[model samples]
Target: MGFFTDCSRALLTILSLTPASNRHFSQHPLALQDITIEPEKASPGFKCQYPSLKGWTNCNGPNSRDCWLKDSASAQPLFSQYDIHTDYESVFPQGIHREYWLNVTDKVISPDGYLKTEGKVVNGSYPGPLIEACWGDDITIHVTNYLKTNGSTIHWHGLRQLHTNEADGVNGVTQCPIAFGDTFDYKFKALQYGHSWYHSHYSLQYPDGVAGPLLIHGPSSANWDEDWTPILISDWSHRSAFQDFYVELGNSTSGVLGREPTMQSIVLNGTGSYTCDPSTDKNCLPQNKRKPIFSKVFQQGKRYLLRLINASTESAFVFTIDNHVLEVISTDLVPIHPFKTESIHIGIGQRYSVIVEAKPSAPVQKDGNYWIRTVVSDGCGTINQSKPEIGVIRYNAGSTALPTSTNHTGLSTLCADEPPENLVPVVPWPVDHQAVNDVLNDTFEAFVSNNVTHGALRWDLTDTPLWLNFSNPTILNLGNTTWNPEYAIIQESYDRGYVYIVITTQAIRKDPSKNTHSVAAHPIHLHGHDFVILAQSNQTYDVSATPKTFNFNNPPRRDVALLPAGNTGGYLAIGFKPDNPGVWLLHCHIAWHASSGLAMQILERQSEILPTIPSLDPTRKTCKGWDKWLAGHVLDQDDSGV
Candidate 1:
């Protein structure tokens, strides 16, 4: 039997063998904070407790916030047996099951006081509902695509789908898109914890609205009095992303060549105020009909854990609240030592879990309100009608007036990630020198070229721009002797060693005229594993000398990191163990660039991938449904099918 099938049978046996009394759900005693366990009706034996429960002092049980699983007396923490040094590739707790259902449909909505008829939403909300679970919990989500004319697939942003490649949910890589009126069940284990967002991987669907927050609760490196739900900040446009993509592609007759789409406004938690001109646009709502500014009520003297995520199409933001110093606790899903900063730069598709004490820099104001700013990073991307002050933080719950607070001075304006030294992982996993040498031997150059199809400009991470076939995905065509060159597959057959990938933007072309080098920084995201950033620099990489500059001792490890821009000859070197036997995607998280073909596939342990999948029956069924629906549709494959 396959790994998933064996897991299913084992789960059934465990559920059936446990006594009825022992299956009763109960919250742990340390659940005094704002975090609460909300089990679904289908999950009968679901039990969740704060990881730092007082009486549970054993090494096998959940450790305290300040304790590690292997060394309970130490200050470093690991969740139960899944601590920092634990080999999460093969070992993880088999926690309770959590089930959720999502319905995706086309709807007309007003997010920033401007109506967009081409909006694609999940469960009738612009920014979909939060999907929460504890670490190691088996999560089953049934996603139904009800869109009248589109195929969809939902990708859980940073979850490592260990041994379960089919659940990764990339449309053209893992599986086919869910056909209209069809429900696809995605089952996988929550191996990593912390907050991330789930969104449609079908073309440009996520930018229109098909997205939501996903929080996998677990132990933290620091303590907080209250935990807030994920705060999603994004650039909102009135027009559909599909229409905006035409401008991005320079395909629209009215659009200028190679121009990025200009967003209309900024939205925080699905609400914003747009300066709508009703005289020129009928879709603009009146002042009284618009939604109020996004705000959060803070209790005095209490520290709050704020999960910050940037879901923008192209813009990078500097997140800050007026007069509040953010004590950053984690980068993406990786726990880090606490560091204080006035503001943080958040790249698109990146997440940060920060602790902000209720104490403001100055004494409490008469209005007790402060502005939450999402400032556009300089040299990043642009928003036409940008509003830095998009939200508010109120000390008084009764206040409805806007904050008169001033902007935080000395905020960083550079379009770069936070300092690498400040993002030190709490639990260090040092890299091997030999592994770094092995990876540097095979370097991948990232560059923009104009020699692609029809001589169109495209960004490439490999030899060619990735253009995938919707009908025949990578998961179904594994173990093949050859692959389509357009698929951009990088094969790594070994299963025992670490895979280090060095991506540099300083690729020198034979014909100088064909080189379309870009100065824009890319937020690179890897699908299957959280890789360590060995070295990142704006200087040109020297294959011989650069190896000495790499930080082999516990570098910044995360799913996404900023690959510096090409103006100064940039490069990003990252390393991850080849433990997950799957065809994982490594791509730029920028919506325009990803759809413009800046991506590649890492086919790790290709020979062993087929044996892990118990059945392709469900995959075949979904593909058949997609093919049948596609036959009657008139949609065009304009860009990359990712």
Candidate 2:
């Protein structure tokens, strides 16, 4: 595509050097305006409500029992949608089915050609819709929000919603928030496989675009050929990640420390180019009509399988591909042990399945078109983008020309993660207890505080800032044994093997008279366990020299990792094995630092998690349909009820 329209005027002359953002975001309380996007069709004779499952197919008829109408009307391409049987360990002996109806709404388009900004997407497309499944499958999806005033959910990110904690779609922690004409459905179980992504944990609605790409297939530490579809590397925002979470949480007259809203471009799957700035006046569209370009088509020496997703709501990418290299098999949803790299650091809500090897070597490259980069990681934010934010890789599918190659020179813009001994885990997993001498440990310390009472700027772990209770949900007050220690409870109770945890971004001080603590790095995430990463460090931790640099043997487990900030503090030490009971959510996958709270709340085995949830009547009928839309609407609930 003319090398993405000549890198879209060199990425809009580098987003015209930022400074003209905000084109009205945060709408959808039904003030609904403009609205004009169409083309998604395919509800034909729809109907397949679990009709004997297994790759479902029925299409109504024969005295239709109204099977909940959901025909994808002959659609395809999510890496062949799902028949994935490469047998790397193949074991879904049957009971595998999948479905999806999705829909959600709002869209104005212009994914990076600067400012069109309306996004919320899905079915109206935008980074949202590539589901696919197969490892112990049994997924379902449905969705439907039509967002006129926002109230949606969808979080399957790193699913291990084991006892299906209300299918773990957090928005007030599991249930409630699918209201704009509601339709929920989720159903879980692809049990631990390879790729991940499916966002919209409400509040700040996944960087104003919900989000997608969520493969499952099964095993792989090697072997490739063409498994490519799921590359999402976001950071875009002309405005409205719920108004950039009020410029990163600052209200009371914008005083209490809130300002991390810089980004205006760095998309990849949903294209990118953004940069209007005729000096300002925002509302751009001609750069050859928002120059989209996420082309792929590799096939030279063949080895492909690149699932890389870093669905950034707060960047931290680093993935590269110029003279291709990356072998790296699986990370989120574990299955590692296959190294080789040229780049592959991904963090905001991580996921990696890399295995490139398309062999593109050539001279001063002309048409083989490389430039896949992503770079951005000024410790996870601030992406001005002069270059290395690209996406093209086209080993001649009748090239459109561009890549002059080069750009792999001693990289280390210093943001960490992907070096827990190169993430080893081809399924070993043996860490028998001991997270810095675990006596059922549960320590934390992440900071960024301004005493957080009314001075606003909160992001804590200790001086409490969790604040979630949307119509009372701790899985509907799990038999309330009186608990709300700022919801930082870690109540485990068996599955005795590990549970440790000990995060620590050096105690406080974002300027406690300045001694250190403005460093960033914290892609923490952990819901339903994948934990183990005993000891990541920038050193300041010293309970006798950080428990002798703990790593109880086979460490490196996944579901997001990367604590490292530094000055003199950033230790991490995780350890999971509360073998999936429920009410999980260990957070920090920064969507403005987990809505300004940097979360916590394990509660596993909380009295055996509601008798191992098979159904709590669809979670109390979706919390009585979110308490009948919270008794005639009024839900803004500031941030972090996610």
List the RMSD of every prediction in angstroms.
Answer: 6.4, 25.3
**What is the C-alpha local distance difference test score of each model?**
0.79, 0.67
> Could you tell me the C-alpha RMSD of candidate 1 in Å?
6.4
Per-model TM values vs. the true structure: 0.88, 0.31
Q: Where does model 1 exceed 4 Å of error?
A: 1-91, 251-257, 436-441, 452-455, 508-513
Clashes of 1: 0
Total clashes, candidate 2? Answer: 8
Clashes per candidate (backbone, < 3 Å): 0, 8
Top of the candidates by lDDT: 1
For model 1, the run of ten residues with the poorest summed lDDT: 60-69
